[model samples]
Target: MRSLVLVGHGSHLNGDSAGAVYYYAELVRQQGIFAEVIEGYWKEEPSLRQVLKTSASTEVTVIPMFISEGYFTETVIPRELGLGHQGPVPEGGIARVIGGRTVRYTLPYGVHPKMQDVILARAREVLPDLDRPEVGRDTTLVVLGHGTTRNENSNKVIERNAAALRERGIFAEVHALYLDEDPKVGTWPERVGAKNVVIVPFFASEGWHTQETIPAELGLTGTATLFTDTPSGPQTVYYTKPVGTHPMIAEVILQLAAEASQARGGDLDRTHAESWRLLTRLAHGGLRVGEVLISPYSGLLELRHMLDEGRPTTDLLTYVTPEGLRDRVRQDDAGEYRPVRTFRTLPRGWRAVVDEADLRRALHYIYPAVVEETRAYTCHSLRATPWPTTARRQTGIYAKVQKASSAQVEAVAQKVCAACLRTRLWAAEPLGQTFFDGVPGGIPCAEACTYLVAAVRDELSAEKSPEKQDQAKLEQA
Candidate 1:
C-alpha cells in the first residue's frame, strides 16, 4: 500500500488549525479512497520528522494544507524533509530520500481549481433565490478572504477566484478583501459599488480570522448572512462561512494527495490505502507526548480520543496565544521558534487570573435585563430596513439602522438582540465570578453576554426565518 501525508501550518494555541486538517483527512477516509492517510503538524505533538518516520512506506505523498505555495511549501517543508532542490543527490548527500518509497508533494489546497466550486456553493447557499431573474441581475457578490501582509500569493488566490467567477457571469460584480495590506476589508463596500453585498470567506476553515476579525471589521451582526434595513425598510448584507469545511473539500484533498504521490513516482491509488491506516492510527494518538505540546486544535481532539481510550492525563498545559492554543508540555520538544500569543483556555486558569475579574466587572454593565434591552434595539435595527448592497445602496432608513447596528455592535448589544446570546453566555460562563468581584446589587447576572453579537444575530435569524415568514403571511392575509 502507498502512503499519503497531510501537512498543515498548525497552531499550538488554536485547535481550529488542526481541526481543519483532521476534518479534511476524515473526509478522505470516509470515501474509502486511500489505503493510508496520516497527518503531521508544525506546532503540535508528533513533529514532522516523527510523522514522516512512522509513516514510512514504499511510496509516500505529502500534501500541504496551506493556502499559499510560497515560503513554507517551497522552502521550509522541503528543507525539513531533506528533499534537495538544486540537483539529484549522490548516494551520500545532505538531502536524501528514504523509506524506499517515492516521495511526491502536491500543491497547497487553496491553489486547487476545484476551490471555485466552494465559492459558487457559498454564493448559491446565501443567495439561492438571489439568482432568480428578478434578483440575479441586481445583486452584487463579494468573494472576500483573509489576504496576507507576508505573502502576495494569498491575495492573488482570492483575486483569481473572483475573476474566474465573474468570467462565468455568476454575479453582477465581484471583489476581494484582506485583513491586512491594501484594499482592506474596511473599504470593500465602497469598491464593489453594488446594491447588495455578500461576503464569502476564501479561508480554509472557521477560526478567529473568519469568526472574529472579518465580521468585526465589516460591522456584521448576524449569521453567515448579514443584512441591514433598506432605505425603503427591508433587509441587506450576506456573509458566508469559510469555504474549507464544505463536503466538496474532501475531494480536493484526495486529488492533491494523488498528484503529490504521482510526482514522487508512486502509485496514487495504493498511496491512499497506506494513508488511511496511518490516519486511523494517528487519530488514536499512537504517538507519545514527547518533549513538546501538540496543536490544541487537533491535539485537543486527539487528547479527547486518548482520554476516551483510557490514556492517563499527562501533565499537559494547553498554551494560549493570539496565534492559537496548544496541548503542550513545558519542554520545548516542538523545535518551534515562533512566539506564542496569549488567550484563555479553561476553568480559573491563566485567562481567569488575567481577564476574568475585569470581564465580570464589565458584565455588570451588561446585566441580563440590560442585555435583553440591547438585543431588542439591535434586532429592531436588523428588521428595520433593506440591507445596503453597496456604498451607493445606502438610503436614509437603511443608513439609520446601519448606524444603529454599528453603535450597539458589542457583546452586550449583540447578545441581547440575536440568538447567539446563549452560546455567548456558555463561552463566557467560566469568568462569571471574576467579573462579579466587586459588583453591588446582589451579583446581577444574565444568560448571554460574550459572543460577537452580529454572528449570533445571523444564527438566530436563519433558525427563525421560516417561522417569521409564516407570521408575516398570516398578518398580511
Candidate 2:
C-alpha cells in the first residue's frame, strides 16, 4: 500500500502553526491518490513518534511541511521516525529501509524549485502591477524568514531563495531578512534600497511571528499597501501574506511526494486493494463513533445513527458514501458548524453502508485520526497527556487554565468532555472512570483538544472577572 505522511512542527501554545499541514492533508486525501494520508507533529497530538501505525503499507512517504530544511527536518523527524542517526540529507531527500518497511523522506517544500513560483504568485497578489516589466524593475522584494542560532542553514535557505529571485530578474532588488540572524527584519529601511518595497514572509502559516512580530517590526497597518517616511524618502511598502498561505504550494508538496512514491515502485491503484483487507480487519469488531454504531453486516460495515433504546431506524437518513457521512457530522441540528467532530452535537438521523475497503477511510472523514488513535490504544502505545500537563504548555490565551483548581477542572471537563464521545483517558485525574465508563469502544483522546482548552480558558476568565468579584462583594454586604 502507498501511504503518505505529512509532518509539521506543531506548536503547543498556538494551533495555527500546523494549519497549513492539516489543510493540505485533507486536500491530498480527497484527491484519492494514496491509500492512506495522515498527519504527524512535533509538539501536538498524533505526534511524530506515535503517528506511524503498523499498517499494511511497506512503503511510506513522509513529506516535511516546512519552508526550510532546518534542525527539525534534518535531525528531529529522522530520529522520531527511526530513520537512523543520520549524516547530511540529500536535496531530493533519502529513502531508508527500517524494520521491513521503506521510509522515503522528502526535503521541505520551501527549498523546492517551485517555491520561486509560489513566492512570485504571492507577490503578484500584493502588487498586481508587477506583471508589467516597469513595475518589476522598480520594486524591491523582501523574503522574510525566521533564522535560528541552533541551525545556520535555517536562514541560509531564505538567502538562497533571495539569490534565485535576483537571478530571475523580476524584482530589481531582492533581500532576505531574518527575525534572528543578521540582515534582520528590523533593519528593513536601511537594508532595502527601493522606493517600491514588497515584503513576504518565507515562513509557514500566519502564526505568532507573522501576525504579531513582523507587523510590529515593519510598522504595518491594516491596509495591504502603506506609505512610510524614511531617511531615504517616502516609500510605498506592499506586504503580502506568507508563502504558506498560497494555494499553489499544494502542487509543490504533491509533486515531491509523487516523485518519491513513483520512484520506489508505488502503485496507487493497487495499494488500496492490498491495504483494504488489513485496514478493514482492524474495524471488524463493532465500535461507536459519536452517536453512530458501526457493526459488520454481510461483509460490509453498517454505520447507524444511534437512537434512544427501543427506538427504530425509521426516520434516519440513509447515505451510501463517506462524503455524505462527513457532511452530516460537520454541522449541528441548527446547521451551525461543529469544529469538534466527536461532540454531542453530531447531527442525528443518518445511516451509511460501505464496504470493508471503504470503512476505515469513511470513518476517518467523520472522525479525524480515529483509526490511528484506536490502534495506539489497542497496542498500549498511546501516551495519554494529563490535562494539567497540557494546560501548562499554553503560554498564550489559555495560560490561566494552568492555575485552575481540581474542582474547576472537573466542572469544565464534565461540561465539555462529557459531551464528547472520546474517552478522556488523559483526564482521568480530575474526571473519574464513571465519567466515560459507559461509552462503547469510545474514541481515545490522547491530549486535551483545542476546544477543551478554549472552554477551560473561558471558565478561568469568568472566575477572575470583575463582575464575579462585584457579585461576591454584594453577597458580603
Candidate 3:
C-alpha cells in the first residue's frame, strides 16, 4: 500500500472543477483504495506542493487527473512533480530526496483503457433514461469532450471511445464533439441527425464547460429534454456525469499500476494479488487502510508496511467550526437560549431572524444551494440538518438580522450564501443550472469577490477602532 495524489487543473471561476476531484477523492478514501488519498488542485487550497509534503507515505504515486496528456501532463505536471521527462525521471524537473521517500509518476487518467470502460458505463447510465422507444434506431449518442486546438489528442481519445461504443451496437450511432474547435456542440444536432441523443462528457471532472458553456451552446435549457426542432423530428437529449467519477474508475487506476509494474519484469499476478485484498477493502469502505499506494511502481505493499504508524491527513476538518459571530448582543437576555440568536442580513428591504439551533441545522440540510426566496450564492457546503423556518432566516443555520443595519446583515447573509454556493449549497440545492434552474438572484463571481473584500474591510475597520486597537496591538506584540 502506498499514497495516492490525484491532481487537477482547478478553476477559480467554476467551483465545480474542484468539487469533482474532491468528491472522487472522498469516494476513493471511503473505498480504501490507498491508506492516503489526497485531492490537490492548481488553483485551490492544498496546492500540489502542499499535498505532496503532507502525505506521510514513503512511496508515493502521482496520477494526473487531467483529461489530456497535453501541456499540463506533458510539461507542467512533470516539471512540478519532478517525474523527469516524457520517458523517465531525469528530463523534466527537480528530483530531491524528501523525508527519505521515493515517488513515482504515471500518465494522465484519460489515457488509461479502463477509463474507456468508465466512459461506456457513464453513457449507459444516461442513455437508458433518455432513450425513446419512438425514436428507435435513429437515436444517436454524442460523446462530448472539452476538445482543444492545442491538444488534438483530447478529442481523439473521446472519438476513439465513441467508435468503441458504436462497435458494440448499443446505439444507432455515436459521434464526438469538441468545445474548442469545429464539430462544436451546436453542430451536434446536425451531425447526429437523430430524434434522440444522449450526450456524455469525456471530461475528467465537472466545471463551467459542463454546467454553463455546453448547455447554452447545445440549446438545452434543461438537462435530459426532448427537442423536435432540428429536422430530426423529436430529439431527446441527456447529459451524464463526467467519466472520471464512475465507480469503475478505481479499477482503471489499479489496472494502470498493474500493467506498469509488469512491464518492468514484475509478476502481474504477484503485484495484483496483494492489490485484490486492498481493492476488497476499498470496496468495503477502507478509509483507514494502513499505508496505501496509488502509483504504478513495483514496491507498493512494502511501502504500505513502511507507512503503518503514520496518521492520515484526511481528517483535516473533522472537528472544524464555522467562523464569525453567531449572535449580536445590543440588549442581552438570558432567555434567548431557548432558541438562541443566529446571524442574518437583508438582501433588499427584507430583514429576518434565524435561531441558533435552526442555523446549525441548515448547515447540513440546505447543501450545495439554499433558496431563501430572494438571493443565493455559492458556499463551502457545510454539513448540518435543516431546522424549521420560524423567524424567516432563523429556520436555517442563519438567524435573522438584529441590532445591526440592514446593509451590514445583508452583507453577512450574502457571504454565508456565497460560501454555501461554493460548497454546492444554494437554496437547499447545488447552485448550478444543471441541478437547479431559475436561480432568482444569481450569484456572480464579481459580487462574491466584492462581498469577501467588504467583509475583510469591515473586520479591519473594527480592528482599527479604538475599542479593538489595544487588543490588536497586544496580539501583534
Candidate 4:
C-alpha cells in the first residue's frame, strides 16, 4: 500500500494555516490514488514524525504546501522528516530512504505552473465580469507574497508567476508586491495604477498576513471592494482569498505526487545526493577566509560541487561575505571550530593574510583609537602546527585575512616586521637565520622575513651614502 503525507506549517494561533493541507489531503483520499492520505503539521495536530510512524504503507509521497522553495521547504521540512540528511530537498524530488520507507517529496505548491490557473480563478470569483472588454482593460491583477531580505530566492516564484499572468492578458497589467520587502503594501495604491484592481494573496493560508496585515495595509474595512483615489483616478480594489484556500489547488498537488512517483520511482537524483554530501564535507572541513565559510550559505558549497562535476560556476563569489561567517558562528552550539582544508584562490587583489596582530592593527586603524581583542582568527599556513598560544588564551580568530590586493598584504607584512625590529621585540640576526634556514615552516614567517631582509638592505644603503657622510662631518664641526 502507498501513503500520501501533506505537510504544512501549521499555526498555533489559528487553524487556517493547516486548513488547506487537510482540504487537499481529503481530496487525494477520495480519489483513491493511495491506500492512505495523511496531513501533518509542524505546529498542529498529527505531527510529521507521528504521522510517518502511524502510516502502514512502506511507500509514501510527501508534498510541501508552500508557495516558494525558501528556508522552510528547503531546510526545515527535510530535517524534521529525517530525509536527505535534513538539508535542502530538490523540488518535486524523491528521497529513496527515510526510516526504511520509499518516499517521494514534491516541490512546494507555489512554483508549479498550474498555480497561475489558481490565481486567475481567485480573481474571477471576485469579478465574474473580468472577461468583459471594458472591465479587463481597466482591471489589474496584483499578486501579494511574503518577500524576505534574508533569502532573495523566496521572491523568484512570485515574480515568475506575475510575469506568466501578464502574458495571458487577463488583466490590463500585473504587479507583484511583498510585505517584508520593497514596493511595500503601503505603496500599492501609487504603484498599481488601475481603476479596477484584483489583489490576490499568494500565501498558503488566510492567517495574520491575509486576514489582518494585508487588509490594514490596503486600508480595507473588512469589505471585498474598497474605493480609493489613485494617480490615475478613482480605483476599485477587489481583494480575493488566498491562493492556497482554492479547492482546485488539490489537483496540482495530486499532479506533483504522480509525477514524482512515475518519473524517478521515488529515488533522489544521484547528482543532488552527491552535492549534499560535498556540502556536509565542506561544512566539516573547508578553508574559511574572512566572512566566507565555504559551508552552505552564499552558494559556495553548490559552486564547489558543480565544479567537481565539471560544470561552470560563474557566480561562485556572489554570496561570499563576512556576515555569512558571523551568522554561522552564531549558530554553532558545540563551539567547535572546524579547520579549513581548501582556500579558495580568488583573483588578484583579493588575497590577504589572516594573523592576530595584523587583524588587531587593521581594526584599530579602522576605528578611532580603540583596541578590542577578537575571539577568533583565520590564517593560511604552509604547514600545520599546534594552535597558537595567544589564540588558546583568547577566544581565537577563525578567519583568514582578505584584502583588496595581494600587494597590500605584502606591504602590511613589511611594515609589521619593520615595526617589530625597531621596538626590539624581534632580533634581526636570529630572524635572518630563521629565514635563510627555512626551518620554521609557514608562508607567513617566510614572507615576513623576505621583506625584513629588504628593509635591512635599504638601511645599509642609506648609511653608506655621501649625504650621510657630509652630515657626519657637519655634526663634528
Model 1 — which ten-residue stretch has the worst lDDT?
Answer: 345-354
After TM-score superposition, the amount by which residue 319's alpha carbon in candidate 4 deviates from its true location, in angstroms, is 56
Model 4 residue 142 CA deviation in Å: 0.6
Instruction: Write model 3 residue lDDT over 1-477, tens digit each, in one string.
Output: 466677887643444456566656656666665655666665443444335544435556667777656766766566545455553222121233443445656777677766666766776676653344454476688778787776666776787787887786667788887777777777876677776677878876556787788888777766577787767667778778878667677666665544433222211223223333333333233221111211111221111111322434342111121111111111123312211011111111111122332222122111111221112122332222222211132211122222234455445556555432232122244435421222332322212222232343465457558979888788999
TM-score of each: 0.53, 0.67, 0.51, 0.53
Query: TM-score winner among the candidates?
Result: 2
Report the lDDT tens digits of candidate 1 across residue range 64-168: 787655667666566545566432222111223554445666667777878988778887887788667667666677767666666676777788888887887
lDDT of every model, 2 decimals: 0.50, 0.73, 0.49, 0.56
Name the lDDT value of residue 241 in candidate 2: 84
Q: Which one wins by lDDT: 1 or 3? A: 1
- Which predicted model would earn the best lDDT? 2
Choose 1 or 2, whichever is better by lDDT.
2
